[model samples]
Target: MIQLVVSIILYFVIFFGIAFILNMLLRRTWLMAFLYPFVVLIIVDNMSTMEYLKAPGSAFSEAFSRLMQITPVDIAILVAGFAGTIVSGIIIKLLRKSGYQMF
Candidate 1:
């Protein structure tokens, strides 16, 4: 239980920090949120970029198989990370709306 909580917080902070910086630099509120799934795919899949390029079908199939095997706790952690990205986007949007210079 402790490990699960730690994992959730760790993932959330990591994603939030990355997304926050990306939002500040890119000046797009939801860019990181929109790209979070692909980031998760890269993290979860074992295939290299070259492998994915060379054998797209097999790579995607393997990735999907691995995705299917993730436990509920892992899914929760991933969801937390996604939520962090969304929250970062919302914060950035709010900051810009309130006349703060984000860029």
Candidate 2:
């Protein structure tokens, strides 16, 4: 619902902002673009924990534990993070191609 949409939007905003800053700092660096998605994975994982769990201390271990079940919202956040990373990369590539500098 609305919360999921908001979370996804927030994920995109953060992911894009980070990627954009890195892209500006490391121009012509494909590694950063490729690694952005993985970075988003970690960020979104943390964000998901904050969103869902009252006890944030255990969120990190719980987020990664395959044995510990995750909710649909977590999955959605992961998916959104991945999608945002990809979109950001593509947008950056296009911007570079068009010679429009952004940060």
Candidate 3:
């Protein structure tokens, strides 16, 4: 209950944090900016899968099983990561257009 809610919040925070850092670091490169987070989400998913594999029968595994489901919070995190990347890309492009360099 409360723990699940907390886990969802944590996942959202971490996912967006990673996307933001990658966005800033690769702002000058459009493809990387758009693609890096997508790849990162795959890694995150893999991590959840690994958690499942490491403990196939336990409360820990059940918690991770719920997290891996297609829940609204999970969807929101994915959307936030994607949108943040695009918004950062657009900001970088606009800055460049205005003769401001991003590095």
Candidate 4:
């Protein structure tokens, strides 16, 4: 489980690292706080769309036929991604409120 923990930490580090850089680069813009979530959703949508498109015609056409087969995994990923974003947002908000002022 140590490996899992390490990877999770790394994920947050990378995401927050990007946020840190973006906050610095886009300081005082109408972008940083508000645009981030929508940006993430759009990115995720594009990626999933690309994955679907890359599958074979017959396979991709029936991809959702097995939707319930991996419901747990899908739910876990959705929860993790949703929770991660909220947690990260809170982390950034708290850090900024603590006078760090990321944006």
Candidate 5:
């Protein structure tokens, strides 16, 4: 239980920090949120980018199977990471609204 909580918080903080920096540097509030799924895909799927391109059908099938096999705790961690990205976007938007320059 402790480990799960730590994992969730760790993923949230890691994703939040990364997304916050990305939002500032790119000056796009939701860029990280939009790209989070691809980030998750890279984390979840074992296939390399080249493998995905070379054998898209097989790679996608394998990825789907892997995704289906993920545990509930893993899903929760991923959701936390996704929430971090979204919260980062909202924070950036709010900061900009308050006249703070993100870039």
Candidate 6:
């Protein structure tokens, strides 16, 4: 339990820390907003996944098995990477290009 909590906190900290650094290099107005945040989240998630790889829980494995739950750690990494590389990128593009009209 404690490990889980710690992992979540660490994720937030690392994500935000990377975000802060990114902000320095590029303004929030730019920097590929949606994609950038996801990239940060993915990096953080990867770290958490490493811990879970040590010993995947039986209860979790069984419960999430239907979700293609080969391993908890694998899931985390996939989710994060998927978010960063795919979902977030698409979202960011849509959002930035959304509300406007020009001829």
Task: Give the winner by lDDT.
Answer: 1
> Against the correct fold, how does model 5 do in TM-score?
0.93
Segments in model 1 whose C-alpha atoms lie over 4 Å from true places: none
Clashes of each: 0, 0, 0, 0, 0, 0
lDDT preference between candidates 1 and 3, better one: 1
**Per-candidate TM-score against the hidden true structure:** 0.95, 0.60, 0.48, 0.40, 0.93, 0.35
Give the distance in Å from residue 23's predicted Cα in candidate 3 to where it truly belongs.
6.0
1 or 3: which has the higher TM-score?
A: 1
lDDT of 4 by residue, 1-103 (tens): 5755665566556655555566556653223346555444443443455655577564444544444344454444444444544555666667677888653
lDDT digits (tens) for residues 1-103 of candidate 2 = 9988999888777766766666677764355557854454455465554534576557655555632465778677766765666676788889888998765
The TM-score-based order of candidates, best leading, equals 1, 5, 2, 3, 4, 6
lDDT of 5 by residue, 1-103 (tens): 9999999999999999999999999897888888988888888888788878899899888887888888999999999999999888898889999999965
lDDT agreement with native, every candidate: 0.91, 0.65, 0.57, 0.51, 0.90, 0.45
After best superposition, candidate 3 residue 59: deviation in angstroms? 23
The pairs that clash in candidate 1 are none
State residue 47's C-alpha deviation in candidate 1, in Å.
2.2
* Model 4: pairs clashing at backbone N, Cα or C within 3 Å: none
Residue 51 lDDT, candidate 5, scale 0-100: 79
After best superposition, candidate 1 residue 43: deviation in angstroms?
A: 1.4
Model 6, global lDDT: 0.45
Predicted candidate 3 versus true structure: per-residue lDDT over 1-103, tens digit per residue = 7766666566555644655555557654355445755464454454554654677576354554544776675566556556555665666667678998646
Task: Give the C-alpha lDDT of model 1.
Answer: 0.91
- Error at 7, model 4, angstroms: 9.3
**In candidate 1, residue 91 scores what lDDT?**
89
Better of 2 and 4 by TM-score: 2
